[model samples]
Structures are given as C-alpha cells and as structure tokens.
Target: MYDQLVNLISTLGFPIAVSIYSLVSLSTKLDELIKSVQEVKEDISAVIKYQKEK
Candidate 1:
C-alpha cells in the first residue's frame, strides 16, 4: 500500500507541474503575440493614411 501511494504521487506530480508551467508560458507568449499584432495594425493604418494623402 505504501509503495502504491508513493508511485501514484510520483506519477501524478510531474505531469501536473509541467502542464501548469506550460499553460503559464503559453499565456505569456500569447500576450506578446497580441501586442505585436496590435503594433502591426497601427503601422498598416498609418501607411494607408499616408498613401491617401499622397
């Protein structure tokens, strides 16, 4: 019983930790991607406005 309990804890712990870490990392990366996309949108709008003026 003790060995089974230990084996169960070990098996469950690492994957859960890795899954949580991956989610946090993905959230950070997604935020960066969103910011970059917003910047690109602004740049495109500026170019369009400039072309219209010319």
Candidate 2:
C-alpha cells in the first residue's frame, strides 16, 4: 500500500509540475506579445500624426 501510494504521488507530481511550467511560459509569451503589439500601435499613431502635421 505504501509503495503504491508513493508511486502514484510521483507519477502525478511530474505531470503537475510540467503543466504549471507550461502555463507560466505561455502567460509570459502572451504578455510579451501584447506589449509588442501596443508598441507598434503607438508607433503607427506617431507616424499618422507626423503626416498630418506635414
């Protein structure tokens, strides 16, 4: 019974750890993507304003 419990826990722990790591990585990538898109939007707005001034 003890060995079965240990085996069960070990098996579950690895997948759980991997899933958490994947989620964190995905979240970081999405945040970076959002920041990059926002930067591009701001740059475009500046160009449009500059053209209008000219």
The candidate that wins on TM-score is 1
Candidate-wise lDDT, in order: 0.85, 0.85
lDDT of 1 by residue, 10-53 (tens): 88886775686689899999999999999999999999999999
Regions of candidate 2 where Cα sits further than 4 Å from its true position: 1-13
What is the overall TM-score of model 1 with all chains considered together?
Answer: 0.74
Give a tens-digit lDDT track for model 2, residues 1-54. 668646755878867756866898999999999999999999999999999999
Clashing pairs in 1: none
7, model 1: CA deviation in Å? 15
Q: How far is candidate 2 from the true structure (C-alpha RMSD, Å)?
A: 6.7
TM-score of 2: 0.66
RMSD, one per candidate, in order: 7.0, 6.7
Q: Which portions of model 1 miss their true places by more than 4 Å?
A: 1-12
